[model samples]
Target: MSSKALEQFLDENIEDLKSRGLYNEIDIVEGANGPTIQIGGRELINLSSNNYLGLATNNTLKQVANEAVASHGVGAGAVRTINGTLDLHKELERKIAAFKGTEAAISYQSGFNCNMAAISAVMDRNDAILSDELNHASIIDGCRLSKAKIIRVNHSDMDDLRKKAKEAVESGQYNKVMVITDGVFSMDGDIAKLPEIVEIAEEFDLITYVDDAHGSGVLGNGAGTVKHFGLQDKVDFQIGTLSKAIGVVGGYVAGKKNLIDWLKVASRPFLFSTAVTPADAAASAKAIDMLMESNELVQLLWENADYLKAGLKDKGFDIGNSETPITPVIIGDEQLTQKFSKRLFESGVYAKSIVFPTVPRGTGRVRNMPTAAHTKEMLDQAIATYEKIGKEMGMI
Candidate 1:
């Protein structure tokens, strides 16, 4: 029989979440996660995917993925430290390094793994990490794993960061100090103040790390946030994901040559975990090549985002300040947010509600992602659906 105590714990917590409207129910996409998706035999104008450039369904990427599978079989077969490092992996890393304007780079199985591996590799118990309170969950876990003195810095508050940085260094309580933040916060869609962050890091001699998971392929002509700010050489570690804009599965750290060398030797995930599939590596490289070749997709993405934002605002719906394409339709109440999302789905839109504890309790929202693949007609329909739902619910 199952352990009664463990079963009780699971049952109680789940029930509490469900009653509070804090539990998230996931929806399955029937086919390609492109501009639109099919669920429950209905097509939805998808506004909840991280596939910013829509490269996930690109014909060229699909072709490359198939070719890689035919040439290299499926899996990488071993951890990167062993025999798993294929020629495709090398080519992908080389492409990433060049794309990010870094001296070298190293790839991991996912963006989460990149943080889990890289953070603990360079930092330890005696060090301290000043992390933005609003950083992704992966970054939080990675910093925790390092056993560092985790100092919470206010979200994009330069003064708070500087004060914390000063205290951390002057106290002489740690061997080394690092300041970490997301390049673009996914929840509210605001860009981080990187120039100020870099300035403070320089003053304190703190190591800098930016997880640009949401910013890549959507900024800096598709290079990333570091390049967007022209601080490519100033940042110590630039973290990115292949699954999002690159439209594949993997993550990487691009930095100085020595840092990449150290991570390749020291990062536990690279040493213990099998590399991403050969197809993933090849397809990712091909996507990067496409981004470097053209700015068409990036421009299209912004245009769609602007149109959606304007439509929502005109309907009197509150879309919080978003400097990037990741838009949040702030609904204020958890139940209301979920209801709003449900109404959207029924109207053939597929945006999802984000509630506590992913975001603060009272700031629940339905996050919208406008992709490059969406045509003007698709966006217009989505906007009209939003307006209808807002009027029905008295939210506008």
Candidate 2:
């Protein structure tokens, strides 16, 4: 039998969450998350994946990944500090630094791990972090782990950030002040104002951290937001994910040589955790090379985004103010949002419902991620389904 204390705690807490309609039911996908996915043998238009460039299932990447596995082994045998720092891992880091236009780059097992590793490595109890109000959960957890005093700046409010930065600098209480924000706000798909942010950071001499997880393969001609705004040299730390657009399983921090050097030794996860697998590292490197080779995929992505956004707006659905390819159909009520998503799945679209904790309570939305792999026909069908279900449910 399960431990009585743990069983009772889980039973009571789970019951409360279920009653409050806050319990999340996980869905199982049978296969690869591509433009279309098979759920229980039913193929549906998949708009829920972060496979932005569709490189996750690209043939070229698969070829290289298979080759890497053949040459090396399936796994990196031990922790990076011990023996897992394979040649593929070092090459990936070099490619990442070149891609980000930074002096050096260090890789981690995952983007979440990168945050937890990088943040705590540079920050401690006496330091402070000025984070965006809507920064990702990983960023929040990373800051918490650092034991730094976290100050939430208003989301994209330049004035508020300025005020807080000024206050933090003048107070003279904290050892160091770091302003961190997502390069692209994932939920709203809004681009971070890096130019204005850099100006503020420069005025106060605060360390700048930009988590470019969403922006890596979407913005700045697929370089990132800092490059998009021509602030790469100014921003101190730029973080990116291999999973999102790179189509692999890792994350990296690109910065000055010294910072990357420090993180290599000081970051807990990098030192203790095993490095990414040979196949994963090789695939990520190939993806980066392709991104740098041409803007063909990026162009296709934006064009597809425009087509979907226009179709949704024409059908009288609110797609929200999104500067990137992430299209969100705002559905205010949580119950209605869930119902809407269920109906979409039934109608053969796989857009997921994002409610509170992900977004503000009343700002629930069904986010559609249109990839370069999606055909115009698929997007049109998705839009038509939205219109049909929306009108049927009186949501339009």
Candidate 3:
């Protein structure tokens, strides 16, 4: 109520974060976050970016974005339902639908907004949502916003999912039921069991939603997890991001034409917020085209991941069971994990430490994102740095 009271409350929270070693101090990257970056005036081999396919600073995407800015003049002045639906937006949506092999698609300002828009647009107070325990924060928030009865299944625990889904359907306590999960668990890099989930969804008549934010441009030869598991038609809502592997900015929901149509009319973000800029839309279209054209970048990314994982494992670091390009060096204590990341940064590497409430407290880790742009030499340097730091910190 009072200024001092509010200030004290904020102070306590800040102290708590520092005490838990979970307080993150943002660092400014001097240039592009490519395979290498300049932070605090020091160049380091960067493993902290979501630029999986190395398309963030790509020349072709840059040129396309530049041209769009020249033509569209920077921003979409109004929301999609208003005056912001440019031809570029439509073209990007069409390309995304084709890439995801879906009937239609709708774009949002960010991947995070896509979750908020899609989930809340479909499921509401009268419905129930069965979500994965380890799904992204955006998914968690989206579920909360929907006012749905949230049932969190154990991470990748199909049996738990099946049991809950059966009970939810049999109870008939909800007007509708939906099951949502990330196509690839971000922290651990493990893929969702879509085949099993799809089977269970069919049995329970639950709507299937897969947020393939990390899986797009990385799985199914860059088509996404739905296509990777051949469940393209089975998954009711296939969500993806243009920000991650697509190497741009924006999010989308690819599904039946009716679903996209409904979202266009009902989703709050689509109706209230300005659409993605023409540059983002154009660049994203080109990124999708790149993924569709060849698997060279994807293959290279996997190879780099394998090399880094193997190297870290050989160095006696507990690299978790990651099936994708995301590799986590598990250091149980939050402070130790933070120290590890700092030391690595100081020694010319740029992987960041992830701690609760991002993950379980005891599972703090330095997550490495190996990209297609990383070379064998770059990874070797990172591995060597890890070994040095791990040994010095008695982590090995």
Candidate 4:
């Protein structure tokens, strides 16, 4: 822990990352990550934000937050197990449960924390988890933390999931088995075959968990992926984020009352960490209310996504098979993908490159996240820029 050793450690690791081209140079956004964002005093069409429905900057959400801040102050003051469970927090949880059509729901600081809190609370060393090979990092961490025997199921391959579930169940080595997957894969925009997963879970008497963080406010009339597939009653755990399409902060787990009650009492984060701020809770509730009141924003988001996808395909960019709005213009080379993203940024589009470690080697891509807030003109301009740069770089 000496200063010299710490410096040596930092220097050695950073240099190693740089040499491997895995060191990411952070970009400071001068303003909001809305349809358009500002960086270095220059504005660009932001195709990289997860603000799918554009509610992050909605005026109604802002007004609700302003009022909550004025009445409740900023911090939650204590952890939920103590006094941090404010009326606003309870209302937010209630609203989310209602939104998700679940008996109860519990909120957490982040989507990452939600996985950590929920998984470790339910599964332990005696239990086993059948997780998608492409599940999020948080899910992996949560599974690991639970001391569960983790089984990897091939991505979206129902047979693999079924095989793993059967194997884990038949082995009788673990007390319980849980099947977990991301409702929508962020990298590929592929939707999980949840109906098959649910069937597999039922056949093996396995617990079903869907992390619908990206699907909420974007699918199933803005309810989520499970709802999109009409398996809300069958899925045991439905996890979602108040961030992303809801356009705020925090995460939640929605399910049967008993499961939620268990989480409230057993989840470490809920018991130890301070709750989300009053402003955040109120704003998130308002956002959910908005999502329920109208599908105008969701409709716009899909329209934009479709428009962008069609435009890109026409221009000969290999946008991988994505069912959601997460469009990945596959470049197949890390350096070229980065250069492509840089060129787009220079031409007023803000998209980032996804390279190795984040993705498999030689499958690098520029991921574009189009929002409902974007205008047709903006999409047109972005497409034009893509065509220009793509050909200039001999990419198409």
Best by lDDT: 1
**Candidate 3, superposed: residue stretches over 4 Å from native:** none
TM, every model: 0.99, 0.98, 0.99, 0.98
- Can you write out model 2's per-residue Cα lDDT over 1-396, one digit (the tens) per residue? 889999999999999866655566788888888999999789999999999899999999999999999999899999998989999999999999999999999999999998999999999999999999999999999999999999999999999999999999999999999999999989989999899999999999999999999999989899989899988899999999999988888999999999999998899999988899999999999999999998888899999999999999998999889999999999888878888999999999999989887889788899999999999999989999999999999877
TM-score of 3: 0.99
- Per-residue CA lDDT of model 1 for 97-196, tens digit only, reads 9999999999999999999999999999999999999999999999999999999999999999999999999999999999999999999999999999
Q: Which stretches of candidate 2 lie above 4 Å from their native place?
A: none
**Tens-digit per-residue lDDT, 123-173, candidate 3:** 999999999999999999999999999998999999999999999999979
- Winner on lDDT (3 vs 4): 3
The global C-alpha lDDT for each of the candidates, from Candidate 1 onward, is 0.95, 0.93, 0.94, 0.93
Residue 209 in model 3: lDDT: 96
As for candidate 4, its clashing pairs are none
Model 3 has an lDDT value of 0.94
lDDT of 2 at 228: 91
Model 2, CA-based lDDT: 0.93
Off by over 4 Å in 4: none
RMSD, each candidate, Å? 0.7, 1.0, 1.0, 1.1
